[model samples]
Target: MDRLTLRLPPDLVRRFDAAAAGRGGRSRFLRRLMEEAAQAPLPAPVAATPAGRTGKLTLRLAEADLALLEAEAAVLGLSRTQWSVALIRRRLQRRPQLTPPEAVAFIEVQRELRRIGVNINQIARAMNTAVLEGTVLDLEVAQLAAFGDEIRAHLTGLRAAFEGNLAYWSDGT
Candidate 1:
């Protein structure tokens, strides 16, 4: 038999097979499975952004630029299609009045802070769960201290970037 075998969760397969067993004809169940398997995933296309108060901004990236995004998306365990949707969302929400350099720095700093905040929340949850479970480690307290340090570091970096010639874009446009 030129059958291509695949491994699926036994429980799920059992459920399907059981349901299919009640069918009068052998082809009915196999046909349903083939139909489901042959169907392609629904396309998740990027949403078109509406113009905001800022002037029109259009961007076209080279294939290599897209490759970089696809690579990053793969690393983050997200589909490239979903990653593009997120990128478009960020772009549309950006304050376009800011100059090019300011826009870049501002977005970077905001992302850094957001990441740090999320990390802090995760750490806090872990710490709380550990405590509830009566698990103690000498380094647990020290690790908890790092959350404040991370916040301070991000804020300091943002301040430094602001103080440096980063006030305006150097593109000299």
Candidate 2:
């Protein structure tokens, strides 16, 4: 492959490096962007829309605030407007917007909780059958108690995680 070089302003390079960090660095990031751009269709010229179809919004933000917004949006691979709209929609809907990592953690926790619930259900069923048939219960009380404790711990952790997510979002970070 042929090599190409371009000179960029220092500040722009810094911003690009920051954005490209943890995303396979500058070269890979630029390559991916170029590939995406090559595959994307060109935008058509703007057309007039019905008056009631959409609304326009304008806001004046401080430089620091704009920088923060740009950084957050960059981290998520979103445009500033897209990120802002998503944040607004999530707030309006009373839903927490989780990052990819957060979503995966939540999914794993939920799966573990479901597995524990299934085990508890099995224990309960076995005990119920034993009681109905007037047979000795083979399960130990300590085992059931342990499961209960485990569930409580898991629930506590889940609650903490949810509260942390809420606080992080609400704090404008």
The number of the candidate with the highest lDDT is: 2
What would the TM-scores of all predictions be? 0.33, 0.53
Model 2 lDDT-worst window of ten: 131-140
Q: What does candidate 1's lDDT look like per residue over 86-134, in tens digits?
A: 4555456532223355567789879987887787787778777765433
- Model 1, residue 24: C-alpha shift (Å): 99
Candidate 2, lDDT over the whole model: 0.81
Counting only residues 3 or more apart in sequence or on different chains, how many pairs clash (N, Cα, C under 3 Å) in candidate 1? 0
Q: List the residue pairs that clash in candidate 2.
A: none
- Check candidate 1 and list the clashing pairs: none
User: Model 1 residue 114 lDDT?
Assistant: 87
C-alpha RMSD in Å of predicted model 1 compared with the true structure: 20.0
* lDDT (tens digit, per residue) of candidate 2 on 66-144: 9999999888767888778767767787677776677888999899989988998888887767653323343445567
Worst-scoring 10-residue span by lDDT in model 1: 164-173
**Alpha carbon lDDT of each predicted model:** 0.64, 0.81
